[model samples]
Target: MELKTRMDGQVAVITGGAQGIGASTGRIMAELGATVVLADVNEDGANATAEAINADGGTAVGVRYDAFDKDAVRGLITDVAGRFGHLDILHNNVGGSWPDRDLQVLDIDDDTWLKIFDWNMHTTHWATTAVLPIMLEQGKGSIVNTITGGAQVGMSIQVAYGSAKGAVSSYTRYVAVQYGRRGIRCNAVNPGLILTPHAVEVMSEDFKRSLFDQITTVRAGVPDDIGYAVAFLASDAAGYINGEAITVAGGGPRSSHDAEALRVGAYGPSVPAPPADLILPDLH
Candidate 1:
């Protein structure tokens, strides 16, 4: 018996595909033989990404997407299905947190909270609803949502953003349970400290260092780390996976290091070193 991960003959639409993780996912899916559509609010960026994919011998197209506009969302999905004849994958990757505005809970205003929800949760709901009909008709489809670690863990800031993403996480399960019988699978990917261009520009050195101190992996995650995960979820390879959120954060925090120290204070005193004569097996 053989296992397959290739997405041959599939048509994939990736929202927010202008750059960062969405663009990377588009490139990866295209490489796996899917005809990828890079849909984004940044039309030029999407076109540039699509052109690059095409130049690399993959099938891809760029289109404008306005996640906040319900009609636009529906129109995008309808247009893609009509043009490609079938839409096999829908990656809802349009989301962001306005760090400046997304302060602690009380500091965040009503408008900011609503905006965060619209960006993170509403967009996902709209896209999923728009694509479900086409997917139901085909009797098979995959939907992957981009969530965030902030939603799963306790965070000091970005309360609204994290809360909105938490809603998305729940929505992922709802879609999977409701449509799994119809051959529709929905899941989410939670990214942690990925060094995308926007992240690099916005994340301060202090913040980066704080995150690095807690991260288990030696280096920060790149867009490809998440792109590959999304590709796998969108492919036949992850057909059995549904309603789950996978963290692509380079293994998250180390159990006994920075995070634990922060949680429980420093070792009572300088902890005594192991006995000098103690022998340890070379597991390596």
Candidate 2:
């Protein structure tokens, strides 16, 4: 059989789909012919996105949801599956780090840690548990959890957030292993410094510049970078890919600190001249 990437006739539910990566993913999946459901706490925003997709000739609906509420999460899944008859994709993307509160491990408070875990880990658990039966009954489904690069690398801040996401990474694998034989596939996508609206609003120029230095690509990552990855993983194109975490951060830093030092001539004349192509464009 020819390789396939189309999502025609499939149904996808994307959490955190009001804006940013979630919204972009909804759009792409809808374009690929899936009936997309954009779920988020931002009810108006979700509806607006759904309206746009419908106007664009794609099937989509927006629903107000609180991922933190187990009952609400279950209801959302149940309603979607009941209406659609099958739920093909579940993108658990509602998660974030509170830079102001998620400080160093010792400095962080218990509430902060709990909140972070709830937002990231608990949400994934609730949604996955709620949807598994439906997917299992159908004998096929794809679940993609959104993870962070910080989970894979050491970070000076957002300790709780990183730890929570680390748990999510492990959970992704467990779900895949336990359900793969039952026609269920679980995977994760690690987004590296994606320039979403919220990211642009909260990230400082200096911070963005510093992050850009660590990225190995010509341009900083946009939501579509991740949206495309989710669409692929959700489609039959990645049928054989399960229980894997794919990093989509424009080829993240290789010895970031050392590379930055070399760029600034920290090693002086002793260091050989770098490749001309190593000089990248200034895009943040």
Candidate 3:
């Protein structure tokens, strides 16, 4: 009973809660007895997600929300707090870059590169700002931001997304320090390559194999892997943990570009060829 009620009476706002990591996070939180708002621009998906949770005897509501709109996000937060009597968590999970548009820094167009910030950092700032006053008034709250693992390490083909998320990570620490004594905590989770449904449908075997080459676990990350991580961080269980970035990736760095011939400075490092047993497969 205690396990199922870990988040009992808490209110959690999960942006992008219609699917993928967002949905999984909501489901787990609901199972723990928290009231979840599955806010997403995809109304149908959000409704479906909420219905599933409600059917399972959990408290949840779906709202058509666009995190990019400052007023809309503010209104959502206000409405949720007024209804729930208080807000306890904000899981900032709304952000993604178009794979087709995301390219090398020099190759990406101005509009495409800038849009990445709108989808990532801008939304995080807007959502966090909206929730601050509410949490402050309540005397406690947690913000779990979803940042990309490539933010600090850098993602070659996804430079724009990585850079924007890097800003989010920095902002997470800033918020943490700013609100620590005020009873609010802010942190970020850096997800490695989580293969959501869209990835499962679109990624080819070769593409997935290449992605797995860098991980020591040699297994693809799934959405549920991220769900549990966010739950713990958003709960009081992590009261002392603030201004940190938790990496949920299976471990290992993306070192393919380090082959020396791929690119200069960009490739990161060069290692002398290893012995037969120490040799790793050539990643494409």
RMSD of each: 6.7, 3.8, 6.3
* Model 3 misplaced stretches (Cα beyond 4 Å): 1-5, 257-284
Per-residue CA lDDT of model 3 for 157-205, tens digit only, reads 9888999999999999999999989999999888987878887778786
TM-score of each: 0.89, 0.91, 0.87
Better of 2 and 3 by lDDT: 2
Q: In terms of TM-score, how similar is model 2 to the real structure?
A: 0.91
Backbone clashes for every candidate come to 0, 0, 0
TM-score comparison, 2 vs 3, better candidate: 2
Best by TM-score: 2
Put the candidates in lDDT order, highest first: 2, 1, 3
Model 2: lDDT to the true structure: 0.88
